[model samples]
Target chain A: MAVATQDSAVRTGRATRFVLYTVLLVFALFYLLPLFIMLVNSVKPLGEITGGSMIALPQTWTFEPWAKAWSEAQVGVEATGLRPYFWNSIRMVVPAVLISTILGALNGYVLTKWTFRGATVLFGLMLFSCFIPFQIVLIPMARVLGEIGLAGTTTGLVLVHVVYGIGFSTLYFRNYYAAFPTELVRAAQIDGAGFFQIFWRIMLPSSGPIIVVCVIWQFTNIWNDFLFGASFASGSAAPMTVALNNLVQSSTGVKEYNVHFAGAIMAALPTLLVYIVAGRYFVRGLMAGSVKG
Target chain B: MGFLDINNATKSYGSVQVLHEVDIEVEEGEFLVLVGPSGCGKSTLLNMIAGLEEISSGEIAIKGQVMNGVHPSKRNIAMVFQSYALYPNMTVGKNITFGLEMHGVEKSTRDAALGDVAKLLQIEQLLDRKPGQLSGGQRQRVAMGRALVRDPDVFLFDEPLSNLDAKLRVDMRTEIKKLHQKLGTTIVYVTHDQIEALTLSTRIAVMNGGYVQQLGTPKEIYDTPSNLFVASFMGSPSMNLIPVTVRVEGNAVYADTTTGDGSPAALAFAAPSEVLKSYDGKTITLGIRPEAITDPEGADRNSTHIQSVETMVEVTEPAGSDTFVTCTLGGQECIARMRADADVQPGQKMPFTINMEKAVPFDPETENRIA
Candidate 1:
């Protein structure tokens, strides 16, 4: 009787696991279906993309669309491709991410360790900035950029990204540093470390996971931003997102569906690469608050 | 002036005063332990001394130099935090040497100091490991090492061993005592554990309600607590306080009390002090340590001050070295520590000897010690 019960229990366990895997597989496909279609269409020729089934593989695989998207795609009046806009993005993103992350680290250190009266209120105000829609700030930002003599340049876009991105970067760093023991800072002070020294030697080194989080967040936000890029930047200084939009939306050409998909994939590649390389740290950063030092 | 002097130090946060005027003077190489319950402002006082918290009033001096408004790093005092705040990213070696490096000590000199501290802490083998990789005790050692490497004029410890387990806490307490002895540095330590204060301090300041109730040597604090609170708080199982009326008959003074079963008993004083004479015909609280009231075999038989009284035991707690017997006296639960070998049982009346010589009397009105 015990053997029979054990056999039935094993059978039930197997059935439950089978159902669980089946459900997981269905959800996996649901999320991956779009990416799979984009990848399939990205490799296919323009004729096949418009003529053949979207799910089927290309009859003759070609890198022409990717090459065209990189070099010869007409974004505006000229066929300057995504290469220049891509470089423009790189110039804006690298500095913006670094500057914003650094400022966030300093803000977090001050808010958590060197706090004074009304520090919480100040932090609350900064956190409120993160929730404000960028569309509302566009006119003021444009005037400010113009007044600051940074308009129509990559510098203007970089400044916008850094300013808008500081809120979130500060929030991430502040919460991370809040979980850190204040004793370490106090100990460092007693050990004769001044403000910047403690930050450079002690706090900054321990900020690995959070730095990755801030960098990835600011990089992705600034990289994929179109509204600010389109409104602020002119012809030559436009970011990749703006150029990609112009390329896809241009009415002068033959639509070029495959080229549009390839351009979309190109714009997404850097952020995807960031995630793939430092994805482990992303999870670690999220779990940092829950698992204290 | 002593090595470290805090005169009339008071701390306030806006309008709320957390610590009242507190005066403490520590001689060179003295280990002063500030002990109190939570919210007693012990930690607040320690932070003020560390210069981490601003002092609202009063002046702090180290080696006769005023330290008010001085930066903590400029104060030349090292502190071991309760959390053992070793930098999580740095190795134990780097954590120990960071202070020296920050002060711009030559790399060779920093290495020498690091080596000495690592050897002293017995963490030489573990220097390469990060704080996250260490055990609680190891982290504690590293924290002490960090403070010790600086060789500062004064050492401040803020409940440094509170995080360890019972056995480890005891072991670390002894190690801290030995460290103080070997280094002979003026140290100010804070803790809420009275036992730790008793075992480690050269002098202890018992705090309550932001006031230093008593500050004296451990023996003085334990044997003659200044008030009812100190007497009750400074001992394990606590000193039992029984309300009694002081009676004077001719040349002798005696306290009128009741046994466990509510039977009236008269406990005659032996060589009563002058303070007790004024309290004649007045009600007072008699404070007695648990060991002072014990089984017949455990009592000092030759002492004239020892008197026997029959009391009914309500319960018995057998701790390995001794048995704590609880009974009612003067309508209050009183515990007596007896030898483990003593044949005692619950719900039975036993003749327990009371050491009246060691007992103290507190005025019922003021709760201050009468004698």
Candidate 2:
């Protein structure tokens, strides 16, 4: 009787495992289906892509469109081309991420650990700014940037990204700071660490999860910023996203689909790299501030 | 000279007052424990002394120097947090020497201090390990070492042992008392544990509702609490407070009450009736600690204001050293502590003696001591 029961239990366990695997496989396919189609279409010739099944493998793969998208597009003349646009995006996005993250960390530190008059009200105002539509302030912000001669420059784009980025960054940091046990800050205070000292020596090192959140959020927002890049830059100062659009537009003139595909891939590579490297931090930030009052 | 003096200190958050006008004075090399329940402002008062929290009004001076606006580091005081907030990024040795390094102490001097404190805390072997790799007890020791290495004017602890397990808490309590004896630094400790307050403090300030209810030696706080809160809060299993009406018969004072097993017992006091004459026919609360109520055989007859009562032992807990017999008296549950070997069982009728000689009377309406 015991042997029969053990066999039944093993069968049940196998059935459960089979069902879990089937569900996971179905979910993975649901997300991968689009990417698979895109990859095959991007490699296929126009005839093969138009005359075959959308799910069919490409009959012939070619790198001609990628090459055409690069040289003939002359994307660098407008901004930095694909190469300089990549560098420009890095230039604009990196500093935007760093400055916003630092400001967010300091704001979160003070808001969470220190008590001052009207701090909550000021935080409330910052929070309210997050919900305001970006379109509402576009004209006024453009005028302000133009008046300062930053309207068409990479520096102006970075400044704009940081100003807009502070709202969400502050939110991320404040929530992250809330989960951090306040006793640690208090202990540092008692150890004689002043404001910046504690922030630099103590809080910053322990801020792995929040820094990931800030980097991922700011990089994705600033790097993929088509609206700001296009609106602010009319000359050789556009970010890679704007330059990628111009590449696609000019690619049709030369019939260069492969270079457009490569440039599209290039435009996305930095954010993809950021996500891959800091994916753990993104998940940790979600879990770190789970317990709050 | 007194090492720490808090003169008329007051604190509040917005309009919600946490601590009222308060005053305390500690002599040099005194171990004072401030104990109260959560939200009683014990931690807040400790923070005020540590300069972690601002005092809304009043002066705090350490070593005869005014410390009102002086930063915590400049105040030259060290504090051990309840959470054992060892910097997670640093090794144990680094954590211990962080304060010294901040103050620009010579590296050789800092190393020597670290060596001495590590050996003192018996954490010499664990010096290189990060705080995350250590157990809770080890992390606590590192926190203490961090504060101890500072060798400041005073050491403030905010419920430092509350995070440890029961056995470790007892061991750490003794270790702290020993450390105090050896260092002889003025220490102000805060805890909600009465036993910790009793064993570790030279003087204890039992606080309630932001007020220091009583500041006295442990025995005084235990035996003669200033009011009902202190009387009820000081002892474990707490003092039993039964409402009773005072009656006088033939120049004798008697408190009439029904025993546990449906029997009447009148407990009498031998003191002069005049001491309680004004309370005749008035309702009052009587406070009696569990240990004060003993078995009849072990009772101190001369000193005992004995009340023989017939009470059914509803529950008997034998905790090795003592047997706790909980019985119902006058419809109120009362616990009595007696010898463990005493033949007592649940659902058995036992004759217990009430030691009323040290019983205190409290005003029922005001919750204050009547005498």
Candidate 3:
């Protein structure tokens, strides 16, 4: 009787696991369905994309759309493709992410360790800046960029992204650094280290997980930002997101669905590749940043 | 000038003062432990000494130099933090040598210093491991090693062993005492554990409410605390304080109290001291250690001053070597330490001897020791 009961329990457990797996699989497919459709439609020629079912695999897969999307797709009056704008985005993002993350780390260190009498209030005000919508800053940012003689340039876009992205980067680093032990800093000071020496040798070395978190966060935000890119930049300085919009919305020629999808995929590939490469660190970073120790 | 002198050191955050004007002087090789309960500003005082926190007012001098605004590193002191504060990223070797490296010591000198510290701490094998990979005791040793490598003018420990388990704490306490003996370095240690203060300190400063309540040798602090707070705070099982009415009969002084069963009792002792002589017929707080009041058989029978009193035992707690027996004196709970093998039982009226020679009285109004 005991053996029979154990066998029945095993069967019930297997049934429950099966139901759980099936539900998870459905959710996974439901989330991935759009990407699947985009991939399937991206490889097909224009005629096949228009005529065939969207869910089906392409009847004859070709790289023409990808090639055209990279080099010859018309965006505005020119057909110079996404290559230049992709480079423009890269130039803007690298410096923006680097500068903002460095500034955030410094700000976080000061706010936590060398805090003066109103430091907490200052931090609270800085944190409040993270919630302000991008639309609210566009006009003021444009004027600032113009006054600085960086208007409609990649440098202007980089400056704008760094200015707006610093709030989030600072928030990430401050939370992580606040959890970091202050005793290490004191020990370093007692060891005859000056301010920058302690930061370089003690604080920055222990800041790996938070750095990964801030860099990835800033990269994704700046790379995918269309609002700031469109408002502050145009022509040769337009970013990938702005160029992709122009490509997809151009009305002079017949609609090219495959090229549009390919352009969208191209614009998203860097961020997706970033996630694929460092996705493990992303979760670990978030967890470490949240925990005090 | 003393080796390290803190003259009227004060600390405040905004308008609220946390540490009042405090003064302490240490000789060249004294292990001074600052002991107090939590929120007593012991840590704040230590930080002030380390130059981590600004002195709100007054002066701190080391080796006859005023250190009010000197940077911590320039103060020529090293601190071992309560958390052991080992650099998480650096290996033990790196952590120990970081100070030397920051001061621009050459590679060879730094290596020699590191080797000496590692050997001294018996942590040579663990030097290559990061702090995260070390056990609690190992981290503590590395913290000490880091401070030791510097050979600073003074060493500061801020409750360094409080994180260890009970057995490890005792072991580390012995190791620290040994380290101090071998190095003969002037040290200022802070802890809330009275046992640590008693065992390791050459002198102790008992702090309460931001004031240094008393400062003296451990034995002096233990045997002749200056005030009621020192008397109660410095001992385990704590000194039992009972309100007793003082009476004088010729040359003898007696404390009148009640037994556990509410029967009247009086304990006769040597004549009251001049300070307490005026308190005749007035109630005062009588302080006696637990061991001083014990079962008759467990007490020093050869002493001429031992006085016996009958009381009902309310509870018996056998703690290995000694059993702590609780009873009532003047309607207040008091504990007596007896030998573990003593024949005592709860709810029984037993004759317990009180070592009247060791008893001290405090003024009820001022809570200050009278005799």
TM-score quality measure for candidate 3: 0.94
Model 3 C-alpha lDDT per residue in residues B1-371, reported as the tens digit of each score:
78999899888888988889899999999999999999899999999899999899998899999999899989889999999988888898998999999889999999999999899999999988989999999999999999999999999999999999999999999999999999999999999999999999999999999999999999889877888999999999999999999898777888999988889999886546766767889999899899999887778766678888898999999999999999999999999999999998999988989988778888878888886
List the candidates' TM-scores in order. Answer: 0.95, 0.88, 0.94
Candidate 1's residue-wise lDDT over B277-311, tens digit each?
Answer: 88888889999999999988899776789888898
Best by DockQ: 3
Docking class of 2: medium
The parts of candidate 3 lying over 4 Å away from their true place are A1-27, A76-78
lDDT of 3 at A263: 91
- Report the alpha-carbon TM-score of model 1 versus the true structure: 0.95
- Candidate 1 reaches a DockQ of 0.82
CAPRI rating of model 3: high
In candidate 2, which residue ranges exceed 4 Å CA deviation? A1-68, A76-81, A251-253, A291-293, B242-283, B301-315, B326-333, B344-351, B354-356
Worst 10 residues of 1 chain A by lDDT: A6-15
lDDT score at residue A135, model 3, on the 0-100 scale:
89
Which 10 consecutive residues of model 3 chain A have the lowest summed lDDT? Answer: A6-15
Residue-level lDDT for B125 in candidate 2? 98
